[model samples]
Target: MPMPEQADAAKSRAPSPAVDRGLTVIERLVTADEEMTLTALAKATRIPLATCASIVYTLEQRGYAARRVVGRSHFWRPTLRLYGLASQLVRKIDLSSVAQPELRALADAVDMPAHIGVLDGATVVYVAKAATAGFIQFDTYPGKVSPFNLTALGRAIAAYLPEDELAPLLTGLVGGRGPAAGDGSAAAFRELLETVRSRGYAVEDQEEQAEVACVAAPFFDAEGRVAGAVGVTGFARDLVDERRDKAAAGVRQVAATVSQRLGCPATALPRPETVF
Candidate 1:
């Protein structure tokens, strides 16, 4: 038998030239600004033209790349199947771990507690948080669940969901047990979602607790889908009126950072009137 180090080195080497060539073609298609013809792919990857044609044909058959024919020429580009596979892997990532650093930074910047939450049916479940020192701690922790319409974190994500998905969540929301809860009609809630989309963030001014409020913004995954949200919670007095804009900006910035880390393109992020 070979020595252990040699065996390890052998295991690390490319095992299949055909598979390597196929992956190279796929990468070239994915990174190219425009579709490439077979000749271009062969030249770029330095594979024989016949070999490159076979690789691309296999990729096309497997739904990883697509072909477009113009007149007699065939051009190829990557398909969303690759993105779908990537999104599946992204979904398995520990979202709380990904957002924790940004959550801490947001808490320190806003001098309040910050949280990250994901949607669970019609509710938002807090999965991680960063608490500030010297503040009266709010009654919230990881695993806390709140109605989607009653918290800024929830609203931030809900606002970006498709209408078909949001409609079911809005069905039974009728003025929950919050001091500031009001106008739970679907029409009113739809209007609120529109505002969230327009402003690039959501606010719950004393909607969950009599003395507390939150400002939040949605984060996205590589597929441009709402993955979760990041929010800061503070006394209602500190999060409204003159102070609200600063807090909202901080929350949006954290959301943007976390979303980018999750593979969301910068262009896919929300652009409120106030640039981040």
Candidate 2:
């Protein structure tokens, strides 16, 4: 169907045969209607039996696949723990006992998943979390260390600190780039933190993960330091458009409450725009 020169050009532009064959094996495993044996995988992928076995071995080592131990041989299955690790990190941050009762009240009042987060080096760690009572809810536990640039909770805390105070905190923390914090992947975070300072609250839409949104406000201590933040996150479909403001209000109220509990007076509450 093609001219000889055109056919030659297409062949030259194509991926190496070994690379294409390897990818084909992976694609077949991903789209299979049923569990595939090494023989079946090799046949479907048009790869050698030894090569297919080697690919499976590599996938298993990386936690992408696991042996099911079906019959006399092993069947590969995907491990879900990779996804659960994110939640586990959030659950590890430590919150004081005094903060729990207020966190519980805020969680119960909003009927949404809520968490208390504090700065831990360069990351914001979830010190505590309360799951909603509803049948469907965002599931988070204490001690999760969410990416600072990617979460409303982190942004809210970033919003209130003085630029000098916060900049070094950001630059000194893990993944920070010294004085030039925005030189690398942290540029987005630097920009977002600036926006959070301009806005009254931090709002996130599908930043941490696709289809999840959140709103957060920061808590300040009597000394005027950024102590922590409280935020709510849920399915994006449930909290789209007009609902964002309500979530932001809730976050502000809870953050204010936590600040008051930490001995910050009503008059001392730092406005989002004033970084003092």
Candidate 3:
């Protein structure tokens, strides 16, 4: 009900806040269609060009913004450090840290390499691992990217990824062959995911290497999401029928103990000695 002049003057007189500008700059930089320029960032955030430069410089110093030499004018994009921060942020429950002791024990029990890996984007990255004192020991260092379709631990973790994310990675493949010509068989891969989900464990029989075999079970977090995978791997020739079941059972027990320690529900875990 105020006069037009009064309302207009009031709107014009309202003080613009600094936090909004800073956050807008950050958002635009993060989601821009292409690499952002200092001028474009300033324009997008409606901040002064000089202020944008200072803000970008501060962000660069903090390792949030990175500048590249595209031509005369510099371009900016985010670094992998952003994903590092995001990974730590998303993992409210630290399954890898809690599974260390059990991992060591499992490694000793199986006398092979046991590892714990969590799904990072589309890859299973090793977070913790132990190796037995065997002559043909396999090294599993932290941050190794396991193949989703070619490894037991990878299958267990990948089984829990959202459908949209899991689909593209597993688009092709008919009976282990490359994706077929319009077969509508992607449904089978989804069924495989469900089979892993229902069975509670996954097995890789010489999938990653001609001589290697692995068995893995899922570790649920506090919220009951598949937080990671705990598994053991050894030479296929070394494992006879008697040892395979024992190894699978041992891996399942260790995975459940780790899940329980991470606050997952008792009913959420699968039965031991069952393979998927």
RMSD of each: 8.4, 22.3, 14.5
lDDT of 3 by residue, 1-276 (tens): 999999999989875576667677877887888888888888888899998998888889988889998669999877667778767755765656776777888888778788888776656788888878756657577778865666678778778877677778776432322222123366755676688778777777664556778888778875687777888888777665877777778778888888788777899776675422
| Residue pairs in candidate 3 whose N, alpha carbon or C atoms collide under 3 angstroms | 173-179
lDDT on C-alpha atoms for all candidate structures: 0.86, 0.70, 0.75
Question: Which candidate wins on TM-score?
Answer: 1
What lDDT is obtained when candidate 2 is compared to the true structure?
A: 0.70
lDDT by residue (1-276, candidate 2, tens digit) is 999999999888966777777667666776777677787788877788998889878878876666667778767654565446545743552354546665676666656787888877667888778777867756566777866756778788877777776777665434432232333345666777778767667877765666777788888875678888888888777676656666666677767767776667888764332111
True-structure RMSD for candidate 2: 22.3
Best by lDDT: 1
For residues 128-202, write the lDDT of model 1, one tens digit per residue. 999999836887799999988899999999999988898898887846556887887989988999999888999
What TM-score does prediction 2 earn?
0.54
TM-score of each: 0.71, 0.54, 0.58
Preferred candidate (TM-score higher): 1 or 3 = 1
Deviation in angstroms for 276 in model 2? 29
Please report how far candidate 1 places residue 35 from its true position, in Å: 17
The C-alpha local distance difference test score for the whole of candidate 1 amounts to 0.86
Stretches off by above 4 angstroms in model 2 are 1-102, 135-139, 168-188, 270-276
